[model samples]
Target: MRQTSYFHTVIIGAGAAGMMCAARTGQGGKSVALLDHAVKIGEKIRISGGGRCNFTNRNLNGHDGSPYYVSQQPRFVRYALSRYTAQDFMHLLDKYGIAYHEKHKGQMFCDDSAQAVVEMLQNECRLGSVTWYTGCTVESLTALPIAPAGYEQARFGINTDQGLFYCRNLVIATGGLAVPAVGASPFGYEVAKQFGHHIIPPEAALVPLRFEKWAEQGFDTLSGIALPVRISTGSGKQAVVFDEDLLFRHKGLSGPAVLQISSYWQPGRHIMVNLVPDTDLAEVLCRDKVGKKIQLKTALKQLCPVLPERLIDFWLGREPFQAVAGQKWADIPNALLQQLGQSLNHWTVLPTGSDGHKKAEVTRGGVDVKEINPKTMQSKQCEGLYFIGEVMDVTGWLGGYNFQWAWASAVCAAEALRADEHI
Candidate 1:
C-alpha cells in the first residue's frame, strides 16, 4: 500500500505563477502544495534582468497604444490582465518595502537584486502556509474516480519520489521550454496533452535569430555594435513593430527590437529593419548630394552618424551600395540615391533559424488559448485542471509583460480553485 498525503490543491512547477497561485489558494484557508524538480525555487526570477529582475512594466495599459503582448487569441489575455493590472503588483512591492526603479520603456527593476523578489514571494507563500517540495521528481499523475469517503473529491492521484499525493484540483504551471539551463521544460505541454487539451506547437520566442554563413559574414565584424532601430514582421493586421535598441552578435541580431520582432517572425518570412528609423535618410542623402563633391563614405557618415562605423563600411561594400562606391555624392544619380535610401530604411533579411530554446527568453506557443478559459485559466474540456504562465499560448513582449502574465494568470487560476472549493 502506498502512503498518501492529501491537499485541497496541488500545483506543479513552483515558478512565478505556481508560487503566486499557492500563496493565494493557501491564504484562502485551503491546504496547498507547491512542487518542483529543482532544488532552488524561483531560479528564473533569480537570473532575470541580470539578477535585478524586470518584475513588471508600468506601461501595461498606457495611452501610447503600443501592443505589449501576443497570442493566437490575443483578446484572451485582456480579462486577466484587466482584473490584475501592473499597478496591483507594484502595490504588492510597495507593501513589502521592496524598492524598485523604472528603466527605459516603463520596465521596473529591483534596486537591489532579483533575490529580493524571490524572498518577497516566498514570504507571501509562507503567509498562505503553502507546503513546498523541491528536488522531487513526479513520476505520474492519474485521474481516479470520485472519492468514496472523507476525501474532498480528490480526483487526481500524483506519484512522486517523495510520496503519493492526492488533490481535488491540480494546477500545471510548469512554464515553457525556454532557457533550459534554468530548468525550463515541455512538461507543462505534455500534461496538457495528457488531458484532452490541444497544444499550439511551441517555438523559440524572444530568442536571437541566426543567419546563414553568407549573412553572418556581413555582421561578424559588426558584433557587439548596438543602436536604436525599428524592426517589423508580418503585414497589415498581422504586422508587429518594435522601435528599440538592437545589438549585433556573432550569431545574428539580438536585442530588444530583434527579440520583439522575432515573436511575430515566422520561418521563411523576411524581417524589415529600419536602420535609420529616427532619421530621414532620403533628405540626408539629398542634402549631401546638393552640389557637394563628398565621396560615398563621407556622405554616409553624416547620414548614419549613430550606426557603427564597421556596419556602415559593410553596407557600403554590398550590393546596390557597391554600385555607388568610389563615386562622389554629386555623381550619384537621383534614382540610385533613392534606392540607397530605401535600402537604409527597409533593409530586409532572412533568418535561417533562432538561437532555439537555449537562448530564448520565452517559448512562443503552448496550450492553445481556445481550449482554455481566459477568465479562469482552466481547461474547457477538463474541470479542475488549470494551466497558467508561459505554458499557455500567450507570449508577451520582451519586457516585463511575460512576468505580468505569470502573475495575472496564476491569480486567475488560484481564484478559480478557491471558488471550486465552495462548489
Candidate 2:
C-alpha cells in the first residue's frame, strides 16, 4: 500500500498561479503540496517577454471596472483583480528587491532576468514550507468518500508517481494550451470537466496571424519591415482595435498589433489595417501630386516617409499601382492617386489561420469563468475545487495583463483556501 501524504491543500501545475497560491496558503499555515510534471518549473515565466518576463501591467485598473480582460463573463475578473491589484504584486517584488522597469503602455519586465522572479517564488514556497513534487505525474484523482483522520475536511485523493496526496482543497492551475513546448496541457480543463464544470473551447491567442498565399501577396519579401499601423477586426460593438507596430513575417503578420488583435479575431473575418495611420494617405498623395515631377513610386516614397523603401517597392509593384509605377506623379490622375491612398489606408486582408498554440503567448479560453466563483476562484459545483490563472477563461490583452490575472486570481484562491481551513 502506498503511503498517503495528507496536506491541507494540493495544487497542480507549479507555474505562476500554483506557485503563488502555494506560497500564500503555506504562509497562512496551511500544509500545501505543489506538483508539476516539468523537471524545471516556471519555464513559461522564464521565456516570457524575451526572457525578462512581462510580469504585470501598471495600467490595470483593479478598481475602475476596466475591460482589459476577455471572457464570457467579462466582469468576472473584477472582484479578484480589485482584491489583489498590480500594486500588491509590485510590493511583493519590491520586498525581494527584484529590479523591474516599465517598457511601454504600462508593461513591466524584469531588469535582470525572469529567472529571478522564479527563484523568488521558489524561495517564498520554501519560506512557507510547501512540499515540492517536481517531475511527478498524476496517475489518477478521486474524491474522497470521507475526510481523512487528521485532515477532517480532506475531500480529494490525488494519486501521483510521487504518492497519494489527500487534501481538503484541490487547485487546478495547470494553465492553458499555449506554448506546448513548455509543458502546457489539458489537465486543468479535464479536471474541470470531471468536477462538472463547463469549459469554453480553447484557442491560440496572442499569436501571429498567418495568411494564405502570403508569398503570392508579396509580403514574403517584406519580412523584416515593420510600421506603426492601426489594425482592427470585427465592427461596431464587437470591433477590436489596436494602434501598435505591425511586423511583416516570412509567413504572415506579427508584432504587437497583430498579436493584440489576434485575440479577438475569428476565421472568415477580414482584418483591416491602416498602413499610414497618422496621415491620410489619399489626401497626401493627391495633394503631393500637384507639382512633383518624380515617378509615382518616388512620390509615394516621399509622401509616406515612414514606410520602408522595400515595402514601398513591394506595394507599388502590386495591383493598380503596378501600372502607374513608372508614370510621373504629375502625369497620374488624382482619382488613381486617391485610389492608391485608399488602398494604403484601408488594406484589408483575410488571415487563413494563426501560428497556433506552438507560437501563441497565451490560450484564449479554458475552464469557463461562469462556472467558477469570482471571489474565491472556486468551482460553483464542486466544493474545495479551485481554478485560477490562464486555466480559467479569463485572458488579458498583450503586455502584462495576463500575468496580473494570474497573480490576482491565485492570491484570491489562496486567501479563500486559507480562510476555509479555519472554517
Candidate 3:
C-alpha cells in the first residue's frame, strides 16, 4: 500500500466495544483513534431491543455460562465475562442517568430510546478524549518483524482518504454481519483472516424463518398467531427451549422463543417444537379422555388456539397418518395416537431457511475466539491486535447477552491496554 504510518492504538468500528476500549485506553493516558465506515456510529445499538435497547440482562447466572456462547473454543468468553459482569454495565448506565426498567426474564432496557445508550457510550469516549473518524475504511494490513521487547513492533498502516495512519495496536470491534445497512461488513472477518485467524463460518441469526410455500399453506394462515415453545435442533447436540411468545409473520416465525432458539439451529435440520412443553404428553392427554377422543385436528386446535385450525388438520391429518385424518381421539389407534403424542412432545419440522443477514438480529460464527485472549480481547498470536464484541466468535442468547459480551470484552481490553505503559 502507501508508506506505513503510525499511532499508539487504532480501533476499528465505532460500536460499543470500540467506544469502550477507546474511552478506557484514552483515560489511561494513551492516544487512541477510532474509525468506522458507516456515517453513523453505534447503528446496531440504536436499533436493538426494539429501539429501547435491552442493554444488559440480570440473567447472567454464574452456574450457567455456555448458554451465551457457541465457539470453536467454548471457554474463550468465560474469562472475559467473569472479569466484567452485567452489573458493571448497569453501573455505567447509572453513571449516565439512563433510566432503564427490568422487563420479562431479567432483561433491562432503556425506558426512553436506544439512542440514549449510544449517546452515553459516545459521551464516555468524548470524556476520555479519544479521537474518531466516521465514514472511513481500511485498505489493508501487514505485520512487521518483532521488535526487541518480546512484543513485536507490529504495524497496521491503514490507507484511508483522511490519511495513512499506522498503529502499534489495532482493535477490531466492527461487529457481525447482521445489518448491512448499518455498515456491518465482512471486513472484520477478512482482517482476522489476514492475521491468519480461522473463521467459524458466519450465518444470520435471531431472525425469522420462512417455510416452503407449497407444504405450509396452513401455517401461513397463522400470520398473527403466537405461543410459548421449546425448540430443539442439531438432532439434540444443540437445542434451546424457551417459553416465550413466538409470533407468526407472513414469511415464517418470529418473537422471543424463535429468536432465542434460532442461535442453536442450523439449516436442513429438523427444529423440534414442544407445543405443550415440560408436562408429559400422555399425562396431558390423559387429563381429559373425552378431549383425547376428539378429532386430532380439534385436539391440537384446542391445545393451542393461537395455531390455525388448518395447520392442526394438516399435521393430525384427516386420518392421523395411518388412519383417517379426523378420526376420533378414542378411535385413533393407540399406536398411532402414541405417534401423535410423540409429534406433539417432540415435533420435528425442518425449516426451509431463516431470514438472511438483512433482517437477522445478530450474526452467528465470527472471528474465531481462540486467536484472541479472553481476559483482554488481545490477540495471543498477534501483538497489539484485539478482537472484541460480535467480531469475535462469542455470541449470546436472544436477550441482552451479546451486548453484555461487548461491554465486558471492551472493558477488559481497555483496562489491560491502559495498564500497559509500553504504548
Candidate 2 residues 1-423, lDDT tens each?
A: 777788889999999999999999999999999999999999999999999999998887567434788888899999988988878889999999999999998899999999999999999999989999999999999788887787677799999988889888899999999988899999998988888888899999999999999997678889988999999999999998899999999999999999999999999999999998888988888776777788988877777888888988888888878898998898888888888899989999999999999999999989988888899998999888999899999889998999889988999999998898342
What's the lDDT for all of these models? 0.86, 0.90, 0.77
Give candidate 1's error at residue 136 in angstroms. 1.3
CA RMSD per model (angstroms) = 2.1, 1.4, 3.7
Best by TM-score: 2
lDDT of 1 at 181: 83
In model 3, what lDDT does residue 333 have?
A: 54
> Pick by lDDT: which candidate is best?
2
Cα shift from native, residue 299, model 3 (Å): 6.0
> What does the lDDT read for residue 191 in candidate 3?
88
Which regions of candidate 3 fall more than 4 Å away from where they truly are?
Answer: 1-6, 61-64, 145-154, 214-216, 235-240, 278-287, 290-340
lDDT of 2 at 32: 94
Q: Where does candidate 1 have its weakest 10-residue lDDT segment?
A: 60-69
Ranking by TM-score: 2, 1, 3
Question: Which pairs clash inside model 1?
Answer: none
Residues 1-423 of candidate 1: C-alpha lDDT, one tens digit per residue? 766889889999999999999999988888999999989889999999889999888877523213577777788888888777788898999999999999988898999999988998899999999999999789999777777366667888899999988888899999999988878888998888899788888999998898888443566778888989999988998787889999988779898888888898999999999999987787678766878788888888877888777877888888777878778999988777887888889989898899899988899889998999988998897878899899999898877999989998999888888887442
